[model samples]
Target: MEHPLSQFKYCPKCGSKHFNINNEKSKQCADCGFVYYFNPSSATVALILNDKKELLVCRRAKDPAKGTLDLPGGFIDMNETGEEGVAREVLEETGLKVKEAIYQFTLPNIYVYSGFPVHTLDMFFLCQVEETSHISAMDDAADAFFIPLTEIRPEDFGLGSIRQGLVKFLSALK
Candidate 1:
């Protein structure tokens, strides 16, 4: 596995090669006294339970985890709250309008895109959709479907954080 900051070879502010790893979480430029701390991006995932007690899932359209089962959500947009982000992501990916979303839990995740592992703070929400009659896979999803809670398997979700999140969610219901 590659280091998260391995791609950063030069300091952005000073354009210097004197940039060195200051610590596990940061880098410092000896030439300019500039320090850069790696911070995790905030992401949201929605757990939408239908009237039949089925959970909505989508197949990822792109890599990182292409064609694998995933929850309906994505990276939160700038200036959007977690709830609002979840709502927007659900609408975009699953065509379901989220009427309400209850905060559930948060987990740290490493999302690798284009060979760079980007750390993320993933927030999971239990969501209620305004309507379930209309659902079409769009945006980042190739397909969308529902699985009964009893039939859900952790391994089905390709993302590590989503698998861990599903474990905790299932445990809480038991």
Candidate 2:
């Protein structure tokens, strides 16, 4: 896979072709003394467990791995914390208001969008719904359902980072 910032040929600030990679995570503009850092974007996912201990999962409705299983989450928007992002994504995708969310863990992921490798930091949260009986799939989720944690196969997740996170989540259960 190519670097996330490999598509950037010219400097955005100075509009010069002299922009060059200063290192793996940054670029420098020779003409205007401008430096750009390619930091990983932050994303959030919710691990909502019901009373039965079944975990909520969603099916993607769009590509970059559409039709694959995923946790209810999305990229964290500017000005929002990871916890807030998880709550918002959960409501948008599952239509369930988050009562509370606790920080679980974070994993680095490479999210390919439109064939561009955008790196991300996926922060997972353990949460519960205010109303479990009323869940309707919305937004980019084609469907959302709960499944036993033991039955979840990491390979079923199309996103490599998600699969890795699931494996860690399962291992922590022991």
Which structure among the candidates has the greatest lDDT? 1
On TM-score, the leading prediction is 2
CA lDDT, every prediction?
0.94, 0.90
Worst 10 residues of 1 by lDDT: 1-10
Local accuracy of candidate 2 as per-residue lDDT tens digits, 1-174: 778777999999989999999998899999998999998899998999999888899999988799999989999999998889999999999999998999989999888888888889999899878977888899989999999988999888878888988898889988
Candidate 1: where is the Cα deviation over 4 Å?
none
- Residue 58 shift from truth in candidate 1, angstroms: 0.7
Which residue pairs does candidate 1 place in steric collision?
none
Superposed by TM-score, candidate 2 places the C-alpha of residue 170 at a distance from the truth, in angstroms, of 1.7
Task: Evaluate residue 117 in candidate 2 and report its C-alpha lDDT on the 0 to 100 scale.
Answer: 84
